[model samples]
Target: MKERRHFIRIVYQAPAQLSQSGAQWSATLKDISLHGILLSCPDGWQPGDDPEFQVDIVLPETDVHLTMTAELVAYDPQSLRMKIVNIDIDSISHLRRLIELNIGDDALLHRELEHLADLAEDE
Candidate 1:
C-alpha cells in the first residue's frame, strides 16, 4: 500500500502501560506521532475481540507522561499499532513538545500541527 501517513513519526522508546477491561500490561513504547502510537506488544496480550485501549507512556526519568485512549488499528506478532482517539490537554501539550524537540524542523512541525488542527476541526 502507498504510504498515506500525514504525521511525522518519532522513534522514541520508553516504558508504557496499556489497560482495558480491567486487564493491564506493560509495554515498550516503540514510536509515536501526533495521530498514533506503536508499541511492542506485551506478553500474554489477548486482544479478546476488543480493540480499544488506554495507554500511559512515561518519559524514562521524568514526570512527563503521555496518556490517551486509542483504538487498536493493527497488530503483528511483535507490535501493536494504535490510533489515538482522545487525549487530555496536558498530555497533548507534552506530546507536542516532545515531538518538537525530536522533529528538528520548525516549519515542518508547524505544518504537521496545522494538519492536525484541520483534522480536529473536521471531527
Candidate 2:
C-alpha cells in the first residue's frame, strides 16, 4: 500500500456535530489532522453523497472554537464512518496550533505546512 496523506493524523476523540441538507448527526471524532478528520457518525452516511456539510469541533470548556465545511470524501456503511475532505484554510493559524498541541511539536507542523504550501504553488 502507498501512503497518501498530507498531514500526520493524531487520535482525538472530541465531540462533533455534522449537518448537511437538513440532515444532522452527532459524531464522535476519531482522528484528526490539519487537513481533515475521520469520525464515527452513528447516523450513518452514503458514499458520494457530498451534501453541504459542516463540522463543528465542539470541545469541553474554553470559548475557543473551530468549525469548517468539507466535502465527504468517503463513508463506510459497515462502521458508519465519515471522512472530511481537506479544509480550506480560513483559520490556518488556529489549525496549526491545534495540530501542534495534538502532535506535541512545532517543527513537524512547520514542515507539513511548508510542504502544503509548495504543493499549492505547483498547482
CA-lDDT, candidates in order: 0.94, 0.68
TM-score of 1: 0.96
Across residues 1-123, which tens digit of lDDT does each residue of candidate 1 receive? 999999999999999999999999999999999999999989999776788899999998899989999999998889999999999999999999999999889899999999999999999
- TM-score: which candidate is best? 1
Instruction: In candidate 1, list every pair of residues with a backbone clash.
Output: none
> Positional deviation of 107 in candidate 2, in angstroms?
1.5
For model 1, the superposed segments whose C-alpha errors exceed 4 Å read none
RMSD over all Cα atoms, model 1: 0.9
Query: Residue by residue across 43-106, what tens digits does model 2's lDDT show?
Result: 6555434544788776557455568776666567423333444454545556677788888877
TM-score of each: 0.96, 0.78
